[model samples]
Target: MAKPKILVTRRWPAVVEKRLSKSYNATLNPTDVAMASNAIATAFAKYDAICPTISDKLPAELFPQSRSRVRILGNYGVGFSHIDLDAAKAAGIVVTNTPGVLSECTADLVITLMLMVARRTSEGERQVRAGRWTGWRPTHMMGAKVSGATFGVLGFGRIGRSAAKRAHHGFGMKVIYYDAFPIAPDLAAESAAQSRDSIEAVLHEADAVSLHMPGGAENFHLINAERLALMKPTGILVNTARGEIIDGQALADALRSRTIAGAGLDVYEDEPTIPAALLQTNAVLLPHLGSATRATREAMGMMVADNLDAFFAGENLPNRVA
Candidate 1:
């Protein structure tokens, strides 16, 4: 039988690329640049399976109106909001994502962001590098204290709970969360987290808020100007979740006016295209490094490989999302 032909949209880790190449007739993007939409559309006709990462935007229009030769979309990341599930389903495509492997690393980045923003580490590093740092004084670069503060979580999924535990156990902070579907009491007790009735309740009380929710139309701009107003003036916000959850312009305005103390973001509403207003603010921004660790990235790729293997063998997909 002929080997299954597959197209990887972006370059994966070296180990993953080697493993994938061994199993299937894989075409890897050597440049590591994002594939253009037209190229992706062509992939549908050429490859038996298309492996896509978050950077690839597979909308309804991208799917062929006629039947596509592609059978499965083995997504490299946990979040599938980038892929239009409705369109994939209509076109008889199965979509699978890698979820469990990335939870700890992503949560670690959340804490890293929270601490960097609260302690003003990014600003301090810039000052030192720019040759502007004077000797330390009692009032030099005063910043918020993360230890023993109230940490609020917007979503209590795997990553959210992991962050809550880090705040509570690692830093001696209080953890409170609000999830659409509350977790079990025992699971909540692990972090000693209390469930709030609404997102507003969590925002109003937390000293620092971390977002771990999914992104879609329902959560688009969910944390807008009005909701931001509910947060304490001393509060800081961190988002490792989808960027659309918070309005970039509103967050920039809040930072400029000192409505909130600071923000640390790993993800943005639009990837690689942050609002010009946000760049001018004191916010600490990162280029979506939530699961960038070597181990995590490899694990995510292996998970995708597992799903693809199962798919080709006509076995149950390990992480089918659609």
Candidate 2:
């Protein structure tokens, strides 16, 4: 039998790429640039499977207007909101995403963001780097205290639960979470977390909040002006989840008006394009580094490889979403 042809939309880790190339007829994107709609459509007609990362946007239009030969999509990341599920289903394309592999690393990043914003480390670094730092004073760069504070977690899934554990056990924080579905009682007890009925209640009570919800039309702007108003004037916000989960303009306004203390954001509403207002604020912004660790990334790639292996070998796919 001929080797199944596959297209990797972006660059992946070296070891996984080598393994994938040896197993299948794999083509890697040399430039590591995000594939355009036409390029994705072209790949759909040419390849048996196309592997994509979160950076690649696979909307409904990218799917073939007619029938498609693409049998499956091996998504490198956990989030599938970037790909249009309905369109993939309509085109008879199976979609699988990598999950559980990056949980610890991503949870670590959430904590890192929480600390960076609450302690104003980014602002302090900027001052020192720009030669604006003078001798230490009694009233320099005073920021919020994270230890023993109320840590609100949105979405109590694997990543959220991991972050709750860190906040509760590591920082001595009280973890309160809001999820549309119920979390296991034992898991909540283990993390010392209390589940809230609504997002508003968590916002009203927390000294610091971290978001870990999915992104799509339903949650396009989950944190708008009214939601921001529910938070305390000194509350800190951290987001390592989907960018659309929070309203960037509202967050920027809240930071400028001191309605909220500070923000730590790893993703943005638009990739590589930040809101002008946020850039000028003291918000600690990162270039979508939530699951960028070498180990985690390789694991994610191997997860995709495993799914593809099952897909071509006529075995059950482990992480099929569509």
C-alpha root-mean-square deviation, each candidate: 0.7, 0.8
TM-score of each: 0.99, 0.99
Clash count of each predicted structure = 0, 0
lDDT of each: 0.94, 0.92
Q: Estimate candidate 2's alpha-carbon lDDT, on a 0 to 1 scale.
A: 0.92
Model 2 RMSD in angstroms: 0.8
**For residues 101-198, what per-residue lDDT tens digits would candidate 1 score against the true structure?**
99999999999999999999999999999999988899999998889999999999999999999999999999999999959999999999999999
- Which pairs in model 1 have colliding backbones? none
Scored by lDDT, model 1 comes in at 0.94
Mark the 10 consecutive residues where model 2 has the least summed lDDT.
Answer: 33-42
Pairing residues by index, what is the TM-score of model 1?
0.99
Per-residue accuracy of model 2 over 163-226 as CA lDDT, tens digit each: 9999999999999999999888999997899989999999999999999998989799999989
